[model samples]
Target chain A: MPELRQEPITKNWVIIATERSKRPSDFSVKKEKRKGGTCPFCKGNEGKTPPEIMAYREKGTKPDTPGWWVRVVPNLFPALAKTGAGETHEQNFYLTKPGAGAHEVLIESPEHDASLETHSQQHVREIFHAWRDRYQALINEEPIQYIQIFKNEGSIAGASLEHPHSQLIATPLIPPVVDEELKGAQEHYQEHGNCIYCEMIKHELGVGRRIVAKNDHFLAFCPFASRFPFETWIIPQQHQAGFDSINDQQLHSLSIIVQEVTQKIRGSLNQPPYNMVLHSAPKGHSHAADYHWHLEILPRLTIVAGFEWGTGIIINPTPPESAAEYLREVNTNLVEEKERLSWQQVH
Target chain B: MPELRQEPITKNWVIIATERSKRPSDFSVKKEKRKGGTCPFCKGNEGKTPPEIMAYREKGTKPDTPGWWVRVVPNLFPALAKTGAGETHEQNFYLTKPGAGAHEVLIESPEHDASLETHSQQHVREIFHAWRDRYQALINEEPIQYIQIFKNEGSIAGASLEHPHSQLIATPLIPPVVDEELKGAQEHYQEHGNCIYCEMIKHELGVGRRIVAKNDHFLAFCPFASRFPFETWIIPQQHQAGFDSINDQQLHSLSIIVQEVTQKIRGSLNQPPYNMVLHSAPKGHSHAADYHWHLEILPRLTIVAGFEWGTGIIINPTPPESAAEYLREVNTNLVEEKERLSWQQVH
Candidate 1:
C-alpha cells in the first residue's frame, strides 16, 4: 500500500508509492522509448483499457465503444487508490496517512496525434467541459479536499503515452502549494480587502508590457516572477474562485487564449515539452472573495539544478518582458496554417 | 541588469537574469555537449576562468596556477552580481530588488575527472574546508542574508562542464525554503522544547530502518518524506545550526560519511546524476537553538511533472525504508576497486 508521509519540519506531504516501488536496479534500465504500437487509448482499443466511467459519445452508442470522442477512465497504475480508508496515524512521532484517492485520465480526443495547440476551438472546449465534469464529481467526495487537473504534453514532460491526454488526481488533503496560496490570499484580503490575483491582473493591464494574449473573458500573460523561461498564466477576467464555476461562454474564451498561447510557444520554441496545471480554490473555498482561479503553463527548457532545489528560488534566464514580447509577436495564423497542413498529412 | 522579483502570493523570489537573458530562438538551440576541449578547471588551464578568489595551493605556486588542489573563482556567467546595490523597491505593487550578491565556483580538484565519491577522503575534507572558508567570508557581508552551497555532479544534473566542482551563491535575503524551515523549527521548538532535527535523529536511531551510513559525528539516512528516489540527508549527531562552525575533526567525519553515502548511491544506482546541497541557518540566526544544519543529496532519477508542480507534493516511487536497505547493502569495497581501475585508465 502507498502511504502519505508528512515532513515534521516543513509539513510538506510526500506520497511514498510502495505499490509502484522500484529497486535500485530498476532505475538502471533506461526509460522506454515511445515506439509504434497499439495504443490503448486509440478508438478501437477501448476494450483494452478499464471500463469507462464517463465519456462523450454518440446518442445511441454504448460506453466503451468507437463513437466516443472524449473519455475518462481510472489510471492503469494509479498513485493513489480508491479503496483505502484515508486514515491518518502517528508512529514514532511521524505523521502518515493511507494514499487513498482517485486517479483518472481524461482522453482529450479519439485521435492519437491530437494536441491542445493543434485542436480546434470547439474540441478544446469539450476537453474543458470534461475536466469541469470531473472536478465537480470529485470535489463532492467525502474525503477529497482538493482536486488537481494537469496535463503533461511530451515524454520529457512526464507523459507516458503518446496519445494526448490530461490527468485528474483527487487528494484527501489540501496540498502545500494551494495552502500557501490560500494563506497569502487571506493575508492580502485582511490587509487590503482585495484579492492579490486581481491586483496582479490590474497591474499587468496597466503596464501592458507582459500581456501575451487577451480576450473579453480571459487574459494570458507572463507572470513577473515566472519560475521557468516562457512560463505563462491564463486567468479569468471576472472574479472567480473555482475553475468548475466557469460558464460556457467563459470557457469558450479561455479555450481560445489557451490555444493561442500554446501555439505561440510551440511555434516559437520548435515544439518544446511543457506542463499545464489548473489552480483553483479548494472544495470549501469556492465562494471565497480573496481567491481567483488561474492556469499555469511551464515550458521545460532548462534543467532544475541544486540551487533551485535548495533555495526554492528559480534562476530564470529569460525575463518575463522578453518572453511576453516574443510570444506576442509570434504569427499564430502562420503557425495554424503550418499545423493544419501537417495535421492533414497525418490524417 | 538582472533583478529579483517576488511573487505576490507565494513570496517566492525569482532571479530575472536580464544580464544573461536569452531570446526565444536561443532555447531552440540544443544544450551544448561537454566535448573534449581546453578544460578550464584542469591543472594547466586555470587562466581560462576568472581570477581565483581563494585556493589551497602549495607554497611555491602562484594564484590560478597548477599547484592548487581546490580553488574558488567567480562564475563566468553568474546568476547574481557583486557590484549593484541590493536595495528593495516597490514597482506596481510587486516587490523588486537588484540581483546583487556573489556567485562563485569551487573547483574540487585540478584533476579533470575527480568526483566526490571517487576522491580520497583528504581531498573531500579539503573541499568542505573550502566551502566553510567561503561561507565564513560571505556571512559577514552587510547586505547578504543567506549563502547557498551546492554541487551538480553530472550533465543531466545541470553541470555545464565535465570537471567536478561546487557552487556558492550569496543572496541579499533569505530564500523561501530556508524561511519555511526556520518558521517550522521555531514552532516545533515552542511546542516541544526540543530541536526537531535532533528528535528526528533520535527517532531514526531508535528505529534503525532508514539509516544509510553513520560515523561518530555524522549520520546519513533516507528521510521519511523523501521527495525523490534515494534522496539522502547527512546530519550531524550534535545539534548545530551553522555549517561554518564545523571543527576540523567534525569535518573529517563529515567527509567520510558523505563520501560513503555518495559511493553507495553511485554503486547501487549505476552512477546516476545527482545534486548535493548544504542547508544551514541564515545569517544572524546561525546560533538559533531550534535550527539544525544538514546536507541533502537528491538523485535525479525521475521526472518531476505536472502533478508535483501543481501541488508542491512529491510522489516518490521508492519508499525510504527500501532505499535505505539497498544503500546500506552496497559493497563499497567493490565500488572502490572499480573506481580505482577507472581512474588508472583515465590517467
Candidate 2:
C-alpha cells in the first residue's frame, strides 16, 4: 500500500506504495534515441567540440586524444557563460543581471556504454576526484557564489545525450530553494543545538525501516518524504558541510555503498531513468554547523500532474518501507566476486 | 534579449527571453486525437464516470443532462479519495496516513471546442462560483487542511485530457513549498511591519516595469523572478488572504482581467500551453495576516532540465519588461465588444 513519509526538516510528505510496486524488468529502458550524426562528444570526434578544458590521460598523451579516461569540456549551448564581469541592473520594478555562470560536462568513461554502477570502484573514485577538482575550481572563481553538480541518466531524466556523464554549473547567486534549506537548518540548529540532518540520521538509524544500504562511513536510505518513487539519499555518517571535505577512505566507502544501492535499484527496477544531485553549501557561506551535504536520487517513474505543479506536493505511488524491503531482497555479489566471475566469463 | 528577474520575497530568479519569442501562428495545436470510444469524459458517457456531484442546469433539467451550462464530478482515478477515515501509522522511521482528500473536476464547457478564453464573462463567473462552492464544501470536511485550484491547458503542461477544465484537490497537510512561501512572507512582515505582497504591489506600481495589466481593484504583472517565460501573476489590490472571500463584483472584475490576459497571451504567443494556479491560505490557518492570495500563470515554453531540478533556480529567456511591453501592445476587447463583433459579422 502507499504510505506517506514526512521530511523531518522541511515537513514534506512523500507516498511510497508497495501495492503498486514494479520490478526491474517492468521498467522500460528504451529512451528516446538521438540520431548520431555530427555528434561532438563521441570518441574520435574531438575536433567537432570546443577544445577540452581538462582531461585525464596517459602521461605523454595529447589533450583531445583517444587515450583519455575522462574529459571535461564547456557546454556549447551554455545556459550561462563562463566569461563576463558579473553585474546586476534594475529597471522599474524589475532587476536583471547578465547570465554569467559556468556549465561544464564531466565524461565518466571512455566507453560509450559504461555507467557508474558498472564501473570499478577505482574508476568511480577517479570520477569523484574529478568532480571535487571541478567544484573547487568553480568555487575559486570570484563571481561564482553557488555550484551545482548533477547527473541525468536517461532521456526521461533530461539527458539529451546518450553518453554516461554528469554536469556541473556555477551560478552567481545562491538559489532560493537551497537558501530555504539553509535557513531551515540554521533555525533548527538554533532551537535544538544540533544539526538537523544529524538528528534525522539518528532517528533513521534507530528505526531502520527506510534504510536501503549502509557501510561504516556512509548510509543509503529512502527518505521519509521521497519526492519521487523509489527515491533515495546517501549521506555521510559524520557531519560534513562540504563535499570537498570527503576523505579518500570515505570516498571509497561511499563508492561501495552507492554502487550497492544503484545495483539494487537496477536489479529491482530494471535500470529506471533517474537524476542524482549532490548538494553542498554555497561558496563563501560560513560553514553551516547544522547542515550536512548529501546526494539525492530521484527516479523518473511517474509524470508530475496538475496537482503537484499547483500545490508543490508530490504523490509518490510507492512507499519507502516496501521499497526498502524489496531492495534488501535483491541478491548482489560482492565486488571481488563479480569481478572474478566477469573475468572468468570473458576468458 | 533574455533577462533575469528575481522575486523579492522568495528571491528566486527567472529568465525572460524574447529572442526566442514566438507568435500564435507558430504554435502547433494538433489536438491529441484520442478515439472517443476509450474516452470516459465524452458526452452520453455519464455512466462511465462517478455520479455528478454538482451541475448548473436549467430550472427543470436533470443532472448529467445536455441542458447544463457546467458540471462538477469526482475524478474516476483520483489521487485522493472522498470516503476514508483518517488514520496515521508509524512504520520504523516513517509515518503514513490514508490518502483521504477530495479531488473534483470542473468541466468548463459542454461544446468541448470552447476554451476559457472564448467564454463570456458571465460564463467565467459561473465557473468561479462553482469553485467557491466546492472550496467551501471541501474545507469543511474532517481531514482537509489545504485546498488547491488550478488549470492545466495542454498535454505538455500536464493535462491528460484535451477538454478545457480545471481541478480542485483538498489535502490534509500543508505542502512544503507553500510553507516556504508563507514563512518567507511572515518573516518579511515581522521585520518590516508590513505585508510583503502589498509592499511588492506598491513597489511594482511605483516602478511600472513588470506590470502587465492593472485596474482599480486588481493588478497583473510579470513577476521579477518568474520561473518560466512569459509567466504572469494576478493579485488583488486589497489585502485578501482567501480566494473564497471574493465578492461578486470583484469576481466580475477578475473575470474581465483574466479574460483579457488570456486573450493577449493567445494572440501574442500563438496559444502557448500554460498552467494557472490559484494560491490561497490553508483552510483553517488563522495567522493569514502575512499571506497573500494570488493567481500564478506559467507558460510551458521551455523544458526544465537537470540544472533547474537540482538547484531550484529557473532561467527565463524573456525579460519581464519585454513581456509586459508585448502584452500591453495587444488590443484588449471586453466581452461586450466581442459580442458586438460576432453579431456584426453574423449579420
Candidate 3:
C-alpha cells in the first residue's frame, strides 16, 4: 500500500506511490547539449556580461576581467528591478508592490562546463564564500526582507545557459514557503521548547535509514517526506539559523558534503537536471533560535502535474530509504571516469 | 519595470517579469505522437482498463462495452489504494497515514483524438455530469474529506495516454493548497462579511481588462496574480460552495463558458499542454458560505526552477491582462478549421 507522509515542519502531505515505485535506473534523462554561441560567463568573455558586483580574482586583476574564478553580475533581465520604491499599494481587495529587489548571478567557475560535482573542493568553497559575501551585502539593503540563494542545473531545471551559475534574489517581502517554515518552527518552539529541525536531525541520525552522507559540520540525507525522487538536504548538525553565519571551517565541510551528494546523484541518475536551494531565516527574523538553515537538492526527474499543482500533494515514486541506499552504493570516482568517456563519445 | 502582484485570497506574491515579457506566440510546443498500440479508453477497448465505476452509455449497452461516450474507471496504478485502515500513525515526531482513498479516471470521450476544446458542447456537458456524479458518490464515503477533479492534456502536462481523460482523486484529508484557500476565504469573510471570490469577480468585471469570456451564469478570466503565463479561471457568477450543488442550468452555462475559454486558449497558443483543476469546499466544511467553487486552467509553457521551488513565489513572464487580450482576439472557428487542415497534412 502507498503511504501519505506529512512533512514535519511544513505540514504538507506527500503520497509515497509504492505501487509504481521507481528505482534509480527507471528514471532516465537525456543530457542537454550546449547551445552554439559565445558563452558570456567564460573567462575572456566577461565583457559580454554586465559590470561585476563582486569577484574572487587574482590580486592584480581588475573587476570584470579574465582572472576571476567566481564572478557576480546583475541579471540583465531581472525578474525584480533594483530601482523601485518598494511601496505596497492596495486597490480595493487586491494588493500590489513595486518589484524592488536585487537579482544577481554568481558564475561558479571560469570554465564553461565546470559543475559543482566536477569542481575541486577548494573551488566549491570559493563559490560558497562568494555566495556568503553576496548574501551579507544584500541583507544590508534597507528594503530587502529576504534573500534567496539557488542554483539551477541543465535546461529543464530552468538553466537558460549551460554555464554553471547560481542566483541570489533579494526581495522586499519574505516568500510564502520561507514564511511557512518560520511559522511552523516558531509553533514547534512554543510547544516543545526546541527547534523542530534539530529534533528531525536527531531522529534521522538515530534511524540511520535516510542518511546519504555526513561530516563534522554537516549531514546530508533524504528527507522523511521526500517530495521528489532523491530529494536530499544538507543541514548543519549544530543549531545554525542563517547561511551567513557559517565559518570558514564549516563552509569547507558543507562544500565537501554537497559535492559528495551531487556526485552520487549524478552517478546514479545519469546527470539529471536538478535545483539546489539555500533556505535560511528571513532578514531580522524573530525566530532565529527556533529555525535551522539547510540546503535542499531537488532532482527534476518527474513532471509535476495537475494533482500536485492543485493540491500541493506530491506523489513521489521513490522512497527516501531506497534513494539513500542507492546513493550509499555509488562510487563517485569510478562514475566520474565513466561520465568523461560517455561525454567524449557523445561529442 | 516588473510588478509584484499578490493573489487576493491566498496572499501569495507573483512577480510579473515584464523585463522578459513574453507574448502568446513566444511559447511553442511540438505535438506528441501516439504510441503504436491499443488505447484503453477508446470505445472498443474498455475491457483493457480496470472495471468501470460509472459511464455515460447507451441504455442497452453493458458496463464495459463499446457504446459508452464517457467512461469512469479505477486507475490501474492508483496513487492511493481503496483498502487500508486510513489510521494516522505517529513515529516519534513524524506522522503518516495509509493512502486509503479513491482514484478514478474519467474518460472524456471514446474518440481517441477528442479534446475539451474540440468536443461538442453536448458531449462536454455529459463529461461534466459524469464528473459531478462521481464526485457526489466519493464525497459520501466515510474516510473521504476532499475530491479533486483535474485534467492533464498532452504528455508534458502528465497525460500518459493519448485518449482525452480527466481524473478524480478522493483523499482522506484536505490538501494544503485547499486548506490555505479555505483559511484565507474564511479570514476575508470574517473581516468583510463577504466571500473573497465574489469580491474578486466584482473586481475583475469592474476592471474589464482581465475578462476573457462570460455568460449569464459563468465568467472566464485571467486572474490578477496568475502563477502561469496564460492562467485562467472559470467561476459561477453566483456564489456556490460545493461543486455538487451545481444545477443543470448552471452546468449548461458552465459547459459553454469552459468550452469557449478552452477553445480560445487552443486557438491563441496552438494547443499548449495545460492542466485544469476544480476547487471546491471540502467535505462537511463549516465555511461553506465563504468558499466559492472554481476551475483553474494553467498552461504549462515555462519550467519551474529553483527560485519558484525555494520561495513559493512564481515569476510569470506574461501578465494576465496581456493574456486576456490575446485570448479575446482569437477567432476560435477559423482557428479550428486551420487546425483540422494542419492535422490532415501531418497525419
Candidate 4:
C-alpha cells in the first residue's frame, strides 16, 4: 500500500509505496561513455553549427572563424524554441505552452580539452563577461521572463558532447523549485524585513563552520541543510537580485573566487563530475529586495533515489561541517599549477 | 557567470552557472558497484540488527528468530531520528527543527535474492498490510505529520546496503515538492470543481499514447511531461485520497497490475533500477473529493544532469509514447520462465 504522507509546514503529500519495493543492489549506474569523434562544436567545424548568436573573437578575426576564444550558437535541437509566440493554453486539468523560449550554447574554449579550473583567471573573467552580456540580451527579448545559464560537466553530469561548453535557455515560466526559494525568501523578508541570503552570509561569516572561500565582495559556503554532499553556494555580500547588474570589479573578484573553488573541488574530489547554477531575480520583477543572487554548486557525488523523489527530503551522506572543512583546507596552490599546465599546452 | 532563471507558472528559480562549466565528454556515467560482504539483513542475523519493530512470523516462531518471512527494524543511522522531541528553533533568518522522525527498514524476504516481481501474490499482499500498519502507527505519534515510504534499488540510486528492503521515514515538515503538487491539484480543483488526477486519467484513457497498464481499479501511464525517462504513475481510477483505505479486492487487483508492470519494465529495460513512490492525500484529510491516490515509478535510465538540476525542466531522450509502447510490448512469459527455473532447481 502506498501511504499519503503530508509535510506539516509545506503541506505537501508524497506517496510512499512499499508494495512495489526493490533491492538496493539492483540499481546499476550507467557506465557507458560515448567517445567524441564526429564532433559539432570543434573549432574548425564552426560552419556545422547554427550561426553564431554571440562570439568573442580576436581583433581582425571574422565571425565564426577559428581565432575565436569563445562562441555562442543557437542549439540545434532546443527544448524550448524561439519560433513560437509565447502563449499558454490550458486543456482541462493540464497546462502547456508551445515551449517558446531561447536555447543557446556557449562554447567555453576552442581547445575543448581544458576544464574551467584549468583556465587562467583572465580567461575565466572573459567567460564571466560573456555570461553577463548574454543574460542582458536574453532578458530584454519579448516574452522571456527568465534566462537559465548552466554548464553540465562530465557525461554523468549530463553533457551530450565532449566539448567544453555551457547552455542558456530563456523560458516563459518560473519553475516550481525556484518558486519555493522565492516564497521562502519572501517570507523570511516579510518577517525580518531583510534579505534572507544576506542574513545567511552574515551568519556564516560569523559562525565560520560552513565557510569554504570568501573575498571582499563574495562569500562561498555549504548551506545549513545542504541537499547533497559537497553542495556549496557562492553569494554576493550586497543585496543584489540580478547577476547582470554585477559590476566589472565584482565580476573580476567573482572570477577569482570561482576559479579557486573549482580548482579546490577538482583537487579534493579528483575532478568529480559536478553542476553549477547561478540564481538571479527574474526579469521584469521590481528589484526583489528580499532575494540576493547567488551561485549553487552541487557535486554529482550521489544520485537522488526513491526517498528524495518521493518525499523531496534529501539525505546527504557528507555533513555540511565536514564538507566545509575539507574544502577550506584544499591547497590554493593547485590553481597556479593548473594555470602553468594550461599555459605550457597553449604555447 | 551562471544566471538564476525562474519558471513562470511555478515561480521557481534555477541557477545556470557556466563559469564552472565542464566538457561534455567528461560527463561519462560512473558504474560504481557495491562490494558484497557478510549480509546484515540475511536470516539468522537478528543480533546484528536493531530489535524488530514489526514482523510476520509462523505460529511458534519468536520475534527476532529465523522463522519470519518479513521483518521491520529501526535504521541505525537514520536521516531523521526517533529520539528527538523535534523542537523547532529560529535563528535570525533561518528556521530548523531537530531531524526527528521514524526511520525503519522493511525487510522484504528472508531469502536475500528474491525480487518483488518473483514474490507470491500473497507475499505482496502481506507487504501492503505491513505498509498500512506502519503508516497508521507513525501518524498516531505527535509532530509526525508525514510518512515517506520508498525503496532505493541499486548503488547508484544511493542504496548503501545490497539487501532487498524498503524504508519508511516519517517527518515533521511537509516537503516542498509535495507542497507544489498539492497546491497545483488544489488550485485545479478550485477552478474546475473536479479532481485533477481523474481528469488526467480521462485524458490518458482517451489518448492511449502514454498508458502502460490499466485495470478496473487502477491505471498506469507515463506522464505527458515526465521528469525522467520511462517514468510512470499508477493512479486509482476512483477519487480516493488515502491509500490505506484501499479494500482487499482493490489490493488483489493492484498487486497483479504492480507485478505485471514490474515484470514488463524488467523485461524491457534489462532489469533497470527504479524508484516507486505512492502519492496519496495527507493523513487526517477526509476523503478529498478533489484528490486521487497514485504511485509514481521513476526508472533510473538517465542521469539528471546540470540542466535538469538547474531548471527543473527535464529533457527526456525517449518520448513517453515510445517508452509506453516499448513497455506494453514486453513478454510476461518471464513469470512462468522464472517459476520453471525455480522448480528445476528444487528438483
Ranked candidates, highest lDDT first: 3, 1, 2, 4
In the range B1-347, model 3's lDDT, one tens digit per residue, is 99999998889999999998987778878778765358888888878999998888899999999888999999998988888877899977689999999899999998887888888888889999998999889887968899999999987888888799999988889999999999999999999999999999987877777888777688888999999988999999899999999999988878877888888887678788999999989898623889999999999998899999999999999999888877766666722232221212211
List model 3 lDDT by residue over A1-347, tens digit each: 89999998989999999987987888879777775359998989989999999998999999988998899999988998889788899966689999999999999998987899989979999999999999988896968999999999988799988899999999899999999999999999999999999999988887777888777788888999999999999999999998888889999888888888899898779999999999999898623889999999999998899999889999999999888877866776722242221212211
Each candidate's root-mean-square deviation in Å? 11.1, 5.6, 5.7, 8.2
Q: Can you give the DockQ of every candidate in the order shown?
A: 0.22, 0.38, 0.77, 0.25
What TM-score would candidate 4 get against the native? 0.85
TM-score of model number 3: 0.95
Model 3: share of real contacts kept: 0.89
Off by over 4 Å in 1: A1-34, A334-347, B1-34, B334-347
Off by over 4 Å in 4: A1-38, A334-347, B1-37, B334-347
How well is each residue in B190-304 modelled by candidate 2, as lDDT tens digits? 9988888988888877777677776657888887777766788999999888887888888877887788788878766767778889888887653377888888888776666
Model 4, span B252-323: residue lDDT tens: 767767777888875556576778787766666537776677788887766777667665766555556666
Candidate 3 clash pair list: none
Clash pairs (backbone) in predicted model 1: none
Candidate 4's DockQ is 0.25
Worst 10 residues of 1 chain B by lDDT: B338-347
Query: Which residue runs does candidate 3 get wrong by more than 4 Å?
Result: A334-347, B334-347
Deviation in Å, model 1, residue A174 alpha carbon: 1.0
TM-score of every candidate relative to the true structure: 0.87, 0.84, 0.95, 0.85
Q: Give candidate 3's total backbone clashes.
A: 0
